[model samples]
Target: MSNTTRSKPNKPDARAKLLDAAFSLIRAKGYCATSVDDLCREAGVTKGAFFHHFKSKEELGVAAANHWSEMTGIFFATAPYHDHQDPLERVLGYLDFRRAILQGEVREFTCLVGTMVQETYDTAPAIRAACEASISGHAAKIEADIAEALARAGMKPDWSAKSLALHSQAVLQGAFILAKANGGAEIAGESIDHLKRYICLLFNRS
Candidate 1:
């Protein structure tokens, strides 16, 4: 007896595939343009599988934002910037890391939640809130380093560390938009360079 038929490989979980699809498609095409059909196609799943995991497209968007946060949280937490003993050095290293990651296409390096929230902020409250949390939470991580640096430098600026942290995100999000408009990452790297310079001036570092 010849046994020639091979067993099929296991497929990824439908929900996880859908999340991965959202990350790619939304960044490439933006949120309002990417429909359920697009996500299902990209994920290699059926419409039924999509609907089974998500009650609505907006619901899926919210989930995607949270998933992005969780994934990037692990990424930034493990980044080598934290290895610096001096807090100012750590902050500058973080900016350097951001600059270094601007490879490939604009869509490949841009933030997923930032792309979604820009389009959905007015229409989808749940998605907007989720995106806000993701951006703010990451900013808070930077704020810790900024605050520590401020203390070490004994510089009591009128502005709060939290405000400066949020401003950094504003610059990054704007840089992504500019990259989309101009079709490259050079502009984004320029913005990061300016940000790093500003941090140095604040910390009185050369």
Candidate 2:
């Protein structure tokens, strides 16, 4: 009888795989409920592999938030919204882009850092800090455009650019919660539209 040889399983990129698994599981089950075992099982890796990369679950949470930030930073930086010549148009386009991307499952479109912070802000300081950095870092990108648009319009606003920037994130995180509760994107889309309308009114954009 001819001997049949089985193919060896491919080795996964343990760190990246663990991060991906954590991002997905945390988004679905919340940070506290998703254990290291769950992440390892989802990642198809061993406990040794998980611990080799991350010393503790908290360490993994921090890394996951940073990974999400880096990934989304690249995604938005290369997005078409940046092509607009007018800063206000760019800002509006960014909102429109965000609304447009809300087509998939709630977990697919929702913010990882936003979800994580809401659950762990009080209990997990390191993870909360990571989440804050990711959210604030993203807000800073839009804040620059807002500042430019304000300067171009020669308008002095009552609110600082930083507040408005953070406000946008607040709206988005709230919208995600509504979408999750309502079990659809309709309410979330409406909320984003309202945000768009408010921004338009603020900038006096017709």
lDDT of 1 by residue, 53-158 (tens): 9999999999989988888887788889999999888888999888888888887889988999899899999999999999999999999999998898888999
Clashing pairs in 1: none
Show where candidate 1 strays beyond 4 Å. 1-11
Best TM-score among the predictions, by candidate number: 1
Please give the lDDT score at residue 5 for candidate 2: 10
Reference-based lDDT, each prediction: 0.87, 0.87
RMSD of each: 7.3, 7.6
Location of the lowest summed lDDT over 10 successive residues in candidate 2: 1-10
Which residue pairs of candidate 2 clash? none
TM-score of every candidate relative to the true structure: 0.94, 0.93
Q: In model 1, what lDDT does residue 67 have?
A: 84
Residue 113 C-alpha lDDT in model 2: 91
